[model samples]
Target: MPQSLFSRMVLILLGGLILVQSISVVFHLRERDRLLFRSNSMESAQRIADTLRLLNSLPPADRHKFVAALNSPTLRISLVTPPSSQPRQSPDGANQAASFGMMLRDLLGENPPIAVTVSEMEWPARQHEVNAPYRAESIHPRQKTAFTVETHLQDGTTVSLDALPTGQAFPLPPRLLLNLLILLAAVIVLSLLAVRLATRPLNTLASAAEKLGNDINSPPLLETGPTEVRRAAHAFNTMQSRLASYIQERTRILAAMSHDLKTPITRLRLRAELLEDDELRVKFAKDLEEMESMVAATLDFMRGVDNPEPLQPMDIMALLESLQADAAEIGHEVRLQGIAAQPYPCKPTALKRCLSNLIDNAIKYGKSATVIVNDDDKQLQIHILDHGQGIPEAELERVFEPFYRLENSRSRDTGGTGLGLGIARNIAQMHGGELVLKNKAGGGLEVILTLPKPITSGSMATKTGAASNIQAKKPRM
Candidate 1:
């Protein structure tokens, strides 16, 4: 299934938006987590430090009251002083000062009045060692109080502080992920709605274009959408109105000219009947014939000015075969080659006339014609070959102008009204096809007709038939 431009545009816009939003959400969550963890950790560490400072300010007799007030199953605190003469090694056979120095630096000032140390242990062991190895000594300047505080909290956690605080493990909240999922779903739904809203006007414009081609008098499209879309719709409506007016003016002018010519042509035909000299009469008749041909061609051209032929599925091969057969019956050496067995959707009658004109011209000048059809998936091409005197490169395009014959002489004996090629080109263009004339390699003219492949039901049916035929004709034992 082929998608229209509007549909493709909508899908692309929504897809790009979704991708950007997803990336933004991920980055946002990561940043939020970083900020949240940093704030939480800072707050927890500050609360612990403040409590220790308050405990230190108390009088010696009121110290027990301070500790009792601070007592909680979720938190514990213990104090340590410097070792006297002999220092007891920590249970892990490591110097406590070295192990706790880094944590002390982090919690307190990097250089404190009293040096501090900190360590970590499991809840049970941390409680058991709270009061062991109590010692007193002076390690700080001017008899400052130096203390070691150990705290055991619920959930099998302990914090041993000589100076600084150790960081805790923190995990992202599950609710954050759930919220992100909800945001993503909402963004997808909203994006789809936005795409639909943006493309609605484009869809209306497409339908209006089809209707306008079918009938110029069709109502203008409703313009409702964003600013850009409304402006575009307005411009399209204005262009259509101008085109209709131009076509009407041209039609009126052609009608008046055609009406005026009829009387003069009729009088001339009547006057020719009474001529005495047969030679003179024949010349007059020839002149009348040329005039009649010109008038008919002009009328056909004028009629096609506004009203183009309707499109339909046409079997190009069958059309070409019929043309070849007709030309052959008239003793013209015409051949058909490389014809596609499939039917293409086009204006059959208009295409038939266009081909006939080319073939007729070939037979007239070269006395032979060849018609070939070739189809690739992209396009359908029809080539008409002739052995006629090829046109000069400069004059190739000029030949398609009405009444612009290559031959300088205006004599009817040359057998051309100079309108055949012009009419053929007009018919081709009406069907969204092009007629191109080029010099053949072997000194003849080649006319190429190129048209877009059609995507209609009738054309599809024809393609199906062609496929079936090819399958049946496949080589077998």
Candidate 2:
């Protein structure tokens, strides 16, 4: 489901590790409980055996004293007449007493007569009867398991043992939780490092691709990393080389054509100069000049889009205001509404040229233009708004095509070689940006020139590091 390869890999690895750890923890805890239960059961039986041996060795007169000394909260020991060998089952059906009876017979040798019975601590039927020679106390009422053991000795004496030893409850292992946390931390750190390493080449490809859009001559990809990544890089590098070659070849052809056409254009201008008729001669010169200007503009646009100037930090606010001031001098109404928060790395000359063209269009078609600069986390936006009739919706996209414009703005009267908006759009796209036009809400046209932020080595830049004249938003009237 994840779009990123790195995220997918991390999810698979972390999910499997957590599941395996969960199963192992569950299994180990259960095994630990079982072992604890078995060991506690063995110890309870041994206690009864050890006390029986000590009691049998003492005389009848000292038996009660020894029994009293051996009695405990869990294990109640005393002497009494041997209970019948008849079976008395417990309420919970726990056969611990039966199991221990067999153990006692083996531990005390075959000659000893031993019998055992287990019952719930709250045995409703009856309690064990102790002989007058016995000195014993009742088992703790809280005790859950009430077991009684009877045995006959060689001297014809009998003794009884009541044990209610509970198995140890499962312990909460803070140590285990601590261990899991440490392991999880180590895994996360390792996963992050591994993901970064795996995704590094893809990141390189992405950066190279982005730069390729701005500069067709972006440097070749590194072609390093895993086998798959290396193959992808190789293909990418090959593609970049082919594209740059193709664009370069096309540019070369256009330049040569423009060069060849210049000679004829100059010859015609010279011939027009020698003509005698004033009206005819002047028209010939005008036609020749217009032809030369169109050729020059076309070639200039080709060069601007494919071969952009080098990037440098520029005060875009000052640049816009300068344009506004220049237009005002020519009696064209241009207003600088807002300014950028910082200077950014850009081809200032190309951008200025692009802005000039857009502002010219806005003023010529829309009567007046206002330039507003706004920037956010990712890109810079410059809006050129005009107060005249907006372009028709159907022709908004067509207006950007070279030599193609709206019927209103494309007339010879407008005096463009039909390359102004096309050239401006190309310049913007060459900087990894877009120039989009839309009709404004209040009855005018708005052209938005969106420029991408400069990509830095470690990360994409969000703020300008160098100081410029404009640090805060201020409008210069």
Per-prediction TM-score, please?
0.60, 0.71
Candidate 1 has its poorest 10 consecutive residues by lDDT at 468-477
Whole-model Cα lDDT of every candidate shown, in order: 0.63, 0.74
Which residue pairs collide in model 2, if any?
Answer: none
Residue-level lDDT of model 1, residues 315-374, one tens digit each, is 677777667777777687888889574577765665676677788888777779888888
Q: Report residue 228 deviation for candidate 1 (angstroms).
A: 7.3
Give one digit per residue, the lDDT tens place, for model 2 in 355-435: 888898888878899888897667889999998888888888887877775556557655667788888888888888999
Q: What lDDT is reached at residue 192 by model 1?
A: 70
Cα distance off (Å), candidate 2, residue 440: 1.6
